[model samples]
Target: MPTITLSVKDENFAGKVLQEVLIGFHSETVTIRDIIEARVLQEVEAYNQKQPQYFNGLVQPADAEKTVNGYQLRNKVVIDPEKQVYVALDAFQKNGFFVLVDTLQCSSLNDKVRLHADTRISFIKLTPLVGG
Candidate 1:
């Protein structure tokens, strides 16, 4: 019924889980955790291109210690397979622009879905109200 897409700067990584994550929307409840897990798996696979086993379980401190795309991943990251929804918001202070990821609509575990590679994102607009 609904579709979910994950767009990444890395084309190869996004292609890995594009089908799986899109298929998760067939049901009524989509879990963002699963989607994130799939992405992480892709990242791990990319990191361990020589050995596939490096991405099997939770990423330990030693795993996070490595660098990826010039960025260092921290051990504080948690991979929870049981989590179902994700609400993410990003704001650009300089440009006054914001984006929100609606985990409820774009999850694969909930309805018929599709995945795409696009940089454009949609978000709801909210205005702060003054209250005493």
Candidate 2:
């Protein structure tokens, strides 16, 4: 059994990384859903420990106010990882954002993603332009 380390990054259309984290998985092959869950869980765990006012996660938590960099909660509280994961999966299905597995765009949550140590996964969130 070997652990594969993948670089998960959040980037914009211009190819700038907003946040980056290295995640490890033992399975060589996983579904897009697995990747999303892992990323969200990791972020939530970190936030829970600190109970920060700002949450920099894959998906915005319910009741959070979206800020320029991340979401700002009304008060510091432990975030629910399950809820965030559910919201993220729904967002992916609704085209709220997109996942890129080393240049290949993921189409479905069940899409099989092959893992490699050097794999670069990028998540680009789509924001509707104001009054466009």
Task: Give the count of colliding residue pairs in each prediction.
Answer: 11, 0
lDDT (Cα, tens digit) per residue for candidate 2, span 31-75: 999998888888889988997778888877776788886788877
For model 2, give the 10-residue run with minimal summed lDDT.
123-132
- By summed lDDT, which 10 consecutive residues of candidate 1 come out lowest? 84-93
Per-residue lDDT, model 1, residue 94, is: 19
Q: What are the models' TM-scores?
A: 0.29, 0.90
Off by over 4 Å in 2: 128-132
lDDT of candidate model 1 versus the reference = 0.30
Q: Write the per-residue lDDT of candidate 1 for residues 1-132, one digit (tens) a residue.
A: 335444422112122221122222333333434444454455444544543322232222233333332323343343332221121111122112222233322323323323344422232222211100
C-alpha lDDT score of every prediction, in listed order: 0.30, 0.82
TM-score between model 2 and native:
0.90
Best by lDDT: 2
Q: How close is candidate 1 to the true structure, as a TM-score?
A: 0.29
